[model samples]
Target: MGRILLFNKPFGVICQFSQDGLHPTLADYIPVPEFYPAGRLDTDSEGLLVLTDDGQLQHRITDPKHKLPKTYWVQVEGVPDSAALDALRAGVLLKDGMTQPAGAALIDTPPGLWPRTPPVRARKAIPTSWLELTIREGKNRQVRRMTAAVGFPTLRLIRYRIGAWTLDGLDQGTWKMNT
Candidate 1:
């Protein structure tokens, strides 16, 4: 059987196993050998990152053609109304091309959410709101771009789930092997 691992990758931590010549990587947390990340979350973003030893599993999760949904909790700079939500659900045209239609809705703050380090800048006049967005494709910075396109710039992004797996009890920089 292949080993499967779920890690809550914190902000500023690279998803790669080694950071010998770069910033902090998975090596700083998980000690498991021969396992690799199923997908990548940028260092500026935080959330669930799955690792596995099976090559096919990695391909299945990372390939956009598979249409596996990745859910994110995003805090945007302004409150989005029904029309904005509709636009996000329909699909947002980006410089890379038009993104696939996504599943999006306003969401309450998740329980036990950790404060991000070097926290996001606050705006006195502008209020922020959270939204749950599930996208089938993982284009570079797609969530941030989509929210921005709808007049609500993203202040922070946390991916909470991928397919059937989720961060669940995993804390920042912590890993659990369940396979």
Candidate 2:
């Protein structure tokens, strides 16, 4: 059986195992060799990231044809109204073209989230809200762009789940192996 590593990536950590020289990368957290990230999360994002050594498994995980669902807990600058949520469900137009329809809903910041090291800046006058967004496509920075398109700029983004795997209780910088 091929190996799978579920890493709860922290903010500022790059997805690659290579040395970036400026910031921490996956190599700092995982010493296992031969595994590659199935998908990517931006350096500014946090939470679940799947890695695998099997090329076919990796392709299935990241390929749009498989339609694996990815869920994110997004902290946005403003509360999204019904229209905004509907737009997300209906697919928002983006510079790359229209995104596939995604599941979007307001949620409380997931109950046991690890606090961000530097922390998202707080604006005293503008309130931020949490959104749970699930999308099938893995477009680069899609969640951030989608939220922004609907007038709610994402202040922080944490991916909570990918397919059937989840961060669940995995702490930041830690990883769990599966076969």
Residue-pair clashes per prediction, in order, are 0, 0
Measured by TM-score, the strongest candidate is 2
- Taking all chains together, each candidate's TM-score versus the true structure is 0.96, 0.97
Would you list the clashing residue pairs of candidate 2?
Answer: none
Q: Candidate 2: worst 10 consecutive residues by lDDT?
A: 170-179
lDDT of each: 0.90, 0.94
Stretches of candidate 2 off by over 4 Å are none
- Residue 124's C-alpha lDDT in candidate 1? 97
